[model samples]
Target: MTQVATTDRALPFDVEAVRADFPVLDQQIHGKPLVYLDSAASAQRPVAVLDAMDRYYRNNHANVHRGVHTLSQRATDDYEGARQRIAQYINARSACEIIFTRGTTEAINLVANSYARPQLGNTSEIVITQLEHHSNIVPWQLVAAQTGASIRVLPINDRGELEIDQFEGLLNDRTCIVAVNHISNALGTINPVNDIVRIAHQHGVPVLLDGAQAMPHTAVDVQALDCDFFAFSGHKVFGPTGIGVLYGKENLLEQMPPWQGGGEMILSVTFENSTYAGLPHKFEAGTPAIAEAVGLGAAIDYIVALDIERIAAYEQQLLDYATERLATIDGIRFIGTAREKASVVSFTLEGIHPHDIGTIVDSEGVAIRTGHHCAMPVMDFFGVPATARASLAFYNNRDDIDRLVDALHKTKQVFG
Candidate 1:
């Protein structure tokens, strides 16, 4: 993969001013200022997103594509407009390539069932990495089971980065598709997706990226990566729950059959004979998440107004600072120290269960995630049941990291 050189400079936006945009951040938890650091799970939505959804429901609420009334046209415009904005945000070839789903999990399941299931057989295999979230892993497992095919795993190293050598060896003629996460949600390692896509394409296989974590921290150009499919959740990117995107290459989508048969997805239907709609609407069935799509559009607009590159740089600095400060605490073991990462730090303190660490930190009003992080294989790789994860977003600053460190120290004191 070719590396692009960029200048290292401070983020341009005033983080405090940006923090004011999120009303939830200006509150107290346990009588202390709420220090939210678990953005990898779900980010706090700004007022723009909230207001967009509110506006959509209050004024333009209607089912899309079917009604001929004024409200229907307005709602349809907002929904389709959101699709276009998302396509531009990701540099997709056209808005038609985007398919709306419940979230990343459903998007992956769509590909697994619609595209891969019919193509795979007893001789075929599916390739994934050990670093994948449960959402990315489970769908393929179900596909393999139904088809009598096998599943192959690309292992990760001690640093939680994929072993590329093993990955190359695993890709063979029997490999039907390659599915992996763009970023490890459990460890924050940024996978080399461009390289992964190139390697898979060489063997006549397509790749699908689970971008739920990566989308919020960095810009994703699906065209540049050349991946066949990409999936991400709106909530993870500061949009709304129950809405996400699945972007597929137009040619591939044309070849794949619709996973669900319902209202808007079809052009005409009788008892036995049915015809499907074109491009995007073929995959997007039913009434769809109208307000959530509008909310996602507002979130995209918010992110674009504050440049994505600037957000990436700011979050990197937060990760570096937090890593440095947390390293000073005694007996704190870092779970993932990848050369390339996003805004997440997973660690475990000496002689303390991760749940205990989480509970103690919560008492001090610091929010962090403590569990297997929906990647139990990752936990097993590090030989721990779970780790305490503190993820960052652009809204976070040096003070949030300091408070987290102080809380960790307090946890140590409580345990002692």
Candidate 2:
């Protein structure tokens, strides 16, 4: 991997200019410059995103798709405009296929409840991987319990890469769905989702990719991947919290029953029977997060203004530099070493609990995630309770990695 030079023109976007756009990054923690490296959990929003939401609430805040007033019309346009932008961001076929939800967790649960529950039978099996977050795991379990279906898990190796052969073996006639993460939140292992989708589709099974971690770092084309469903959180992509997207193939989405019933999701409500709405509106219940959706559009615009390839290249360099630095530290054991990985590093120190390590790092103004990260199965596979994770983004630079390494050394010295 090539190291990014401090004077590289490849990064057309100025780091200082970008940093200035994020107000939160200017703060001090423990009397030192804050080093935030948990983008996988949530990304810091730019001024554009914050301004978009503020602008919406200030001027165009109104209920969508209902009122005939001008404010309602503007709000509806902005809200639907955000959907269109998201559709283009992920290269989905149509805006009708995109349904906004709370986040990735709710998106998966929507699929499990609406599609999997209706289609899967008593003997049907839902195959997922150990790399999945609990959001991806528990929903299928609930669906299985309700439908008399079973849940099968694909295992991983010590390096935290998925066992592809085992995954292939598990795809049989009885498999109804395959729910996997595009990138592991805990390990940063970028799974071969295209292959997983192809294999599952061969058995006439649909695949749902949890793309929370993958969307921020790479470009995703739902059409090219040909997965039945893809889901991600807006907060994970430099957008607002409490807003996410669920993208399904048009046919698949049309076939799935509406998961929730309320005002916007309904066409006609009688005392006896109620008729549901169509496509995206069918899945979106009650009043949607209008301002947040508008802010997500602005976030997408901010990302679009930057060259994605350049951003990804810069992030890869950061990952490599961080990995090399961590490797040189004694007693620092990295949990994930997949051939293809992302901008996340999960590790543990020999003599320190992950929480203790996190506390020490906090003292140095370095922020990292320390826990199972909602992927306990991966922890079980690795034979550890939890590992400290430093998930990076394009805005992060080499200086952040230096701070992380220095903090890790201090953690070891204090604990050892």
lDDT of 1 by residue, 239-307 (tens): 999999999999999999999988999989999899999999999888999999999988988888777
Among these predicted structures, which one has the highest TM-score? 1
lDDT of each: 0.93, 0.90
Q: Would you estimate the TM-scores of all the predictions? A: 0.97, 0.96
CA deviation > 4 Å runs, candidate 1 = 1-11
lDDT leader: 1
Off by over 4 Å in 2: 1-13
Which residue pairs show backbone clashes in model 1? Answer: none
> How many angstroms is residue 238 displaced in model 1 relative to the true structure, after the best TM-score fit?
0.5
lDDT of 1: 0.93
Candidate 2 lDDT for residue 255: 86
**Model 2 TM-score (2 dp):** 0.96
